[model samples]
Target: MSTRLDELVQELGQADRQERIELLIDLARELPPLPDRLAGSRDESHRVPECQSPVFLFVEPAESGRIRLYADAPAEAPTVRGFVALLVAGLDGATPAEVANLPDDILDRSGVREILGMQRISGLYGILRRLRALAAQLPQPESPAKMPADTPSADPPSAASSDPSTAAASTPDPEALIAALRTVTDPELHVNVIDLGLVYGIQTQGHEVHVEMTLTSPACPAGPQMIRDAVAALEKVEGVTKAHVKLVMNPPWSPDRMTDAARDELGIF
Candidate 1:
């Protein structure tokens, strides 16, 4: 069985440009519609927004109507945004509460830098206003969002501790360890770091451990997040300690490094 990320990748490849785009637009429509009650919630301007990127993100209230957002990036722009929108749309049918249940691996499926970049997301609030208006006209409907147990989460106090040397020295639990790290993905690629071949090296001797990793882009926004998440992911290992993480920009990440599964997910064939 593939992870939700795997399902999303396959779906994106199968969708046409227009279909992929509208799918995101619909997700923008799914965020809980903000209300006059949210006066204390926002900065008081209370205006909505649109997604210029293919993916649209919004925080929604558990109850009531819908929140709509859209950002129509030029088809020529970088593609990952569209991919995000596409994936989120498929995930959107679930209630905001349910969607929130998603593990960081599936909901975020992105490297730390990517999640952090969202803090400075640009363009298209106008589209959000339009979607919100559109939702008001439709009959209200709801669904439950359930997070699968295997999903990856992005909570704090990462497995990587204040002391990398100590963390690396602990005994290891490979399955739990890999599960934790699989949650770390290349932000732009929205794919697991493991699949991206970003992990350059791993050396273990008894309890002591060492690790090396790289970014998909030299200036990736998810850098800090990836670093932080990597440490956390590795920290979960029982015998692992001193989980050292090193970042490399040389050689860079290439399509050649992509796993066969990753490639097939992108429909490269």
Candidate 2:
């Protein structure tokens, strides 16, 4: 393990829930300011679209084999900022090979998974994957493209198909759509959104499907990523060609909406 990562794991391991959050915020504050060229709207190419927050990341390779990481996240999204802060600080000055070999489950060891939830953990993985991809430019072994096991595919099936038979065969089933959605978990609550009653409705028209869902809170930072993941999950079904998600605030979510199984898992009376 890298020294910095080891130290981070130790620090996180010792902190309680609230203290861990405070430590993350402190790390966010410590993230060095990005150079003007890489800040603001200038670095669109470096943006991590997989992140719920509008996070931009860039990797700079040094002659000495070490690489420098630059990242920017909104202050409103402190959790993401902190996550990027952790990566920037921990991986700074590490060689491209070192980063490429970094453990896939490093975040799990950091104890952040218990606090930040799976969505944020998955976003962290997205950052690492992008970082490694950038670093691979430095003459690394060729590896087949692979999506993170915990993340949904970023590329959905193309809506435009040349064959009508193919398009018709790709029509999604409502039952299958709901089943695929059951695989998505609420980041904060750690419960499947279906069981939590976050899914308001599902509709399918030929090869296109639409879903209506709500977040536990109107201000949930993970909302965008969740929607993206939902779309991706739907698109992965054998017959889905297009997936559309609509966020609904009306008929707002409540604990009362959760299934008895969810309540049991959460220890709610």
Candidate 3:
């Protein structure tokens, strides 16, 4: 199976122009605030000089026996912040070996080159180089023979496992599936597919699910990405084994289909 970073790369790589931008902004908002304990560590030694924005990063072993990354970037530089956030999310809690082995073309694989200018792209690579350097400072994990039998796993528990509504459901709940789908946003609208009324129907059979959905238009560039995202969301449900997404333009999609909240966000009133 692919690592979390690989999944993120595939998602960004498949996304349309508008969706990519929106996803990056969403990631920027998720960058954890630098903890007070590391406040003074923001010196030039920890900074990425190639980036126009002042960016600082630190890596350390976590209590869980995995790794943790802390970073700081100006709010004005959402693009930079977003890239940092992606690295942090994908690599945090990962084993040191995993971080060391990450591909150098990770940024290029994410399709970010199409979105950023050449200078910004160069700076992003610099950030990657700096992060790897910091991660290199950590002690490597010991051999299994030298470690305890109860060592913590590198992968974290899924969000679904923590939620009673999904975790305890004997069968896959349509509502749970819907909740998962809500995570998938329309690239152009920046509103979730659920709120946009793109999903026409959902059916569950045993551990499998089938969904019928539509796009804003047949020509919409972001349609494929939205479909892929929706499928990804559904499969994340606790009881779901597979998710099948079918595109249907027969009913089509319209502004009137948008929920009140989506309308408000778009100033559609």
Candidate 4:
């Protein structure tokens, strides 16, 4: 059998853009999610106590090449959403100095928790990186003013072949769309669709958008309802003319999807 990497490399060379993207989704299925909790019990780590409750974490990429990070922490459990957001923020282009010098007060604030549906600061930074990388590899944009100084200091080959208007029209601000998605609540879970892991990836191409997520239960009868709700939520976002949802079952769901913070709040250890 061909390994995912081998298949991906082969697919990369294919002429069809759709086929290459299909390979990306297929390869994603093979990736092992990051571990949620450290080994050992609360007795092992006196500094951080574990919750007696349960929590779950789920992440999915959007059509716009952004990821939706979800955490389901019942009220009974502690909420580590803030910490996860901070980690994500630091992952961005902020200079090591900027990230390191950040005040603890800012990190301790619950604003991050309230904004779980938004892109982690670092996630949007990735878009800036990719834009630059592709630009470097490809031809320079017709308008230099459109490029930000911090934008990919070293431009790579440009994957952007269209004009500035086409490029801007195609890309959606990852953070903005994520914030919009947070408003969507799972009809059954009663929490934000984001918290219930009902909203996964969001993708945008020109005026079209696609979201990919999975229901907690494979046989969920609310699948259609969830899809409708998600589409409705995304359509409300400005600049989105079309939206779609794809429910993926590959690799299955488990507590492993929970973030480090979610694990701590739930004491999943």
Q: Judged by lDDT, which candidate is best?
A: 3
TM-scores, all models, native as reference: 0.33, 0.50, 0.51, 0.37
Off by over 4 Å in 2: 40-43, 139-269
> Candidate 2 residues 120-203, lDDT tens each?
576776666666555544543333222222233345535444356666666666668878888888888888778887885666
lDDT of 1 at 81: 44
| Candidate 3, superposed: residue stretches over 4 Å from native | 142-269
In the range 1-269, model 3's lDDT, one tens digit per residue, is 12888888888889998998888899899988989999988886677877778999888888655788789898898878887888888888887657645666777778887789666587786677566545544665752221112323233444654566765665577678888988999877898888887775676545656677788889989988888898899989978877777787743455544645322322100
Model 3's lDDT to the true fold? 0.72
TM-score between model 4 and native: 0.37
Question: What C-alpha RMSD separates each model from the true structure?
Answer: 16.1, 14.7, 20.2, 19.6
Candidate 2 has an lDDT of: 0.70
Considering TM-score, where higher is better, how would the candidates rank from best to worst?
A: 3, 2, 4, 1
Model with the higher TM-score, candidate 3 or 4: 3
lDDT digits (tens) for residues 1-269 of candidate 1 = 12553566455445565664454445334433334554344431222333444333344433354333322233443333444454345444434323323333432332222432555433322322223322322333552212212223343334454456765555575555556667988777788977776764454434434555677778788888998888877866776544656675533454434645322222100
Per-candidate Cα lDDT values, in order, are 0.46, 0.70, 0.72, 0.41
- Which residue pairs clash within candidate 2? none
